[model samples]
Target: MAADPVVSVDAVSKVFATRAGPVHALRDVSFSVPRGHTLGLVGESGSGKSTIARLVLGLERPTTGAVRFESVDLSAAGRAARKRMRRRMQMVFQDPYSSLLPHLTVLSNVVEPLRLHGIGTVAQRRERATQMLVRVGIGAASAGFYPRQFSGGQQQRIAIARALVLEPEFLVCDEPTSSLDVSVQAQILGLLQGLQRDLGLTCLFVSHNLAVIERMATEVVVMCGGRVVESASTEELFAHPAHPYTRRLLAAVLPLEGDAPPLPADDWDPASLDDDEREVVRISPGHYLRA
Candidate 1:
């Protein structure tokens, strides 16, 4: 039998009460991240990708369904149990510059997580942080420098070091390279892939770039207006997209590819998220990264 999933989002739905009204960010969206496998979330700006990431990480509770980490329902998990779970799971946000402490040095940033979790002694945390930074190509000598002193790629490396210092089993990366320079994007992705291989990590990777998703994920979930239009192995989905929305997405990203059929003008309207039902689900308010 297949091994149990490391992370499972079971029929989860999230609605936010905004000044305008209730916005349904996720509508019965569900998927699982198998051990050592990366599940990619793909869609345009407001398709519920980031919302799913927050829900999976337990940073945000689903308005209506359950999020289970290693089969433990987060909604039902006790305070202490949830705290323990936090140490085992971590997130790599889209903007490393904003995520990392501007005032803390590189080493301090990486060591902060260890310190907060009480994972090791001062010396041990320093050693651990140094090793992680080195693994991500940051030398110990540069650890004392603040976030502004490093390049964008280097800042991201430090952010990653911070996340991995905990040695977590599950990682949630939401558009991790979206803000990096093009050449640097590949380097960072390579580092993540190598680290994931070495650590046997299960990951939930969210991105709008189809090419990146195709490279990093074994499976892909295509979301359209708060609903999963297609979920399949990377190869199968790219080779044969069953949903109309998925086809449009593939065509937009890889226009030259023959598999993505040409679109009929009336097939999809960018303005609306209606699929015969005409249900309009706006993204949650204040979620700058509109899922």
Candidate 2:
């Protein structure tokens, strides 16, 4: 009797075969993004955060388990079904410069998905793209400019416009603001927050910055070593971090002037943890911690 999640990753694991051996990119990861909410995925490099993004988008098949979108199992969907599912989901990558084609004009870049999906007439597509650009704070006059002509923030705005023009119900934002200046990042974050609120979008926002996650996410999933170390509502997780890794991560957040540095790593060592501590333990309602 409950509505299905917009996106769901269930017991998913990804192992990439390399020359040396199989690299386990993800390990039995499970999470869900409900409609009209943002699920923040935070972790350091090599934490398998990006792998989760790829799995949800069906860009990579899981070695084990499933990724479902709109109650459709993406890994098992046929080509046509997968394509149809893709139309309802979109992604915003970290680097805007590389995401937008250098040769295409800004307007063309934004409308590219519409044209590819055959969503509307040429005129209609143009009109829609123009409106989206304006919504992201880019004026209609600059729509003709090339990606290189814009600053880093502007390029990211263009990328956001492109991703949202399709009006997708789910958005996977992979460090979408990490490349911009602090001021620009704030603007982009504000824009995303506004867009999500107005459009009732469900988002999976990936970033390493806890501060940013605190600002944007309704729920947070903290990952480490290809596994989710902690999952909770933003407020609860920040207030009470049960996992040593989670505590270490929070300690590492840069502080203001005169604030002390994070405690040393020797204080909390994963190598010393027991097996039960390594498993996800429910701390309270809607909160889980890896001991």
Candidate 3:
């Protein structure tokens, strides 16, 4: 049998009440993240990728349905339980400059998580934090420098160090390399892959870049307009995209031989779709596509 999932989002729906109207950010979205596996969530801007990330992190509660970490429902958890759960799961944001403390040195920022969780003694935390920095390619000597002193890539390295310092079992990365240069993007991706392998971490990697997702993800979920249009193992999804939206997304990113694949002019209209009907269909044992 397959191992139980470390993270599970079960028929989750999220609606945000904006002044304009009620915005449905997620619609019965459900997926389980197997331990030691990376699940890539790919979609364009305003596609609700970040909303799902927030729900998984327990930073935001779903309007309906459940978000579970280690089989514990976040929405139902008490404050103390939730706090303990949050420590096992960490997040790495796209903008490391904004995420890291501007006033604190890299060393202090990295050790902050450990200190908050009361993971180790001051000496042990410093040593572990320094080691994490070194693992991310930042030397101990540079740890004293502030965020502004380091380059964009270095700042991200520090952020990654901070996230990993606590030895988190799960990681939620929201476009973590999007802000970096092409060269630096590759470096960060490589570092993340290496760290995941070394630590046996389960990850939810959210990105708009299909190429990045293709490289980092073992399995992929393709979202469009707050719904999952397709989900499959990385190789299968790239080779055969079952949903129209997923195909359009692939065509936009992957190059074709002679001419570009023609996409439907009609934008995804939620009003046209029937919520009562099955929106997603199983194409194979493990692969699913929007019906």
Write model 1 residue lDDT over 1-291, tens digit each, in one string: 026899998888899999999898888777788888998899999999999988887889988889999889998898889889999999999999999999888999999999998988999999999999999999999989999998999989999999999999999999999999989999999999999999998899999988889889998888878877667788877776666677677767644446554444237664455433433232322111112
Candidate 3's clash total is: 0
Q: Considering lDDT, which of the candidate structures 1 and 3 is the better prediction for this target?
A: 3
Runs with alpha carbons beyond 4 Å of true place in candidate 1: 254-266, 270-291
Give the TM-score (vs. native) of candidate 2. Answer: 0.94
Using TM-score, rank the candidates from best to worst.
2, 3, 1
- Ranking of all predicted structures according to lDDT, beginning with the best and ending with the worst: 2, 3, 1
Instruction: Pick the winner on TM-score between candidates 2 and 3.
Output: 2
TM-score of each: 0.90, 0.94, 0.93
All candidates: CA RMSD in angstroms?
6.1, 2.5, 2.7
Per residue, candidate 2 scores C-alpha lDDT tens digits across 22-58 of 8888888888987888999999888899999999999
Which tens-of-lDDT digit does each residue in 1-291 have in candidate 3?
Answer: 026899999998889999999988888898888999999999989888999999999999999999999889999999999999999899999999999999999999999999998988999999999999999999999889899999999999999999989888999999999999989999999999999999999999999988899899989998877888789999898877777667667767744367455444335454444363566788887799877
